[model samples]
Target: IPKTPLWKRCVQYTDILGKRLLKKIRLQYLQDNLEQRRTARSSNLLSLCRPTISLDPIL
Candidate 1:
């Protein structure tokens, strides 16, 4: 039987590497978005509590 060509190996490696890079970029974007949301929630909670704490002393 005949052997396979070397060009096929290069094509396969290129496709695999491209997919792996895309997956990594997508994961990083998701993590950054989650961190932003968490920060916003904490700041909102702090602002909501400020008014109640300030008014409790007079009432």
Candidate 2:
């Protein structure tokens, strides 16, 4: 079989690399968003629970 030409191969390689890079960036973005939401939820839960915890000692 005849091998593909150099320019087409380069284009195909670059296209694959670009897609992989974009996927990596999107994954990182989602992870950061999830981390931020987790932190916020934990902080909110702590704030909500603290007063109840202090009240429990007096009860």
Candidate 3:
């Protein structure tokens, strides 16, 4: 059997770590958004978003 080079092994390890970190961050972000929405839902109607406000991301 052939052995993987040291650099290739490092690359594979980093790839796995990167994917795990990405998944963790995504889950955290989703939870945070859900929590924020729950709080927002309980706010007074008068304190809600105004039509003039925009949340669009800049290109």
Candidate 4:
């Protein structure tokens, strides 16, 4: 039955928007970390599979 003031509503909206943005940023950071780990693991595996050979003509 009572209407809220415009400034109060704006403050509430800004709070909600800030929380949502923080959540999105956190999720993106986690995803980037996961991807980095995955790539590092794959690179390790590839290095393990490939053998290093010397280019010198001496046997």
Please give, for residues 1-59, the per-residue lDDT of candidate 1 as tens digits: 12333333334455565666656655765786678886884546565657554544565
Candidate 1 lDDT for residue 50: 73
What would the TM-score be for candidate 4 when compared with the true structure? 0.40
Question: Where in model 1 is the C-alpha error above 4 Å?
Answer: 1-17, 41-59
In every candidate, how many clashes are there? 0, 0, 0, 0
The Cα RMSD of model 3 versus the native structure comes to 13.5
User: How would you encode candidate 3's per-residue C-alpha lDDT over 1-59 as one tens digit per residue?
Assistant: 12543333344456565766656655766786778777784655433556576678999
**Backbone collision tally, model 4:** 0
Q: State the lDDT of candidate 2 residue by residue for 1-59, as single tens digits.
A: 22533333344446566766656655766787778887884456555656554444564
Q: Give per-model CA RMSD.
A: 14.5, 13.0, 13.5, 13.8
Model 2 TM: 0.41
lDDT of 2: 0.57
What is the TM-score of each predicted model, taking all chains together?
0.40, 0.41, 0.41, 0.40
Clashing pairs in 3: none
What shift in Å separates residue 44 of candidate 2 from its native position after superposition? 7.1
Residue 34, model 2: Cα distance from true site in angstroms: 0.1
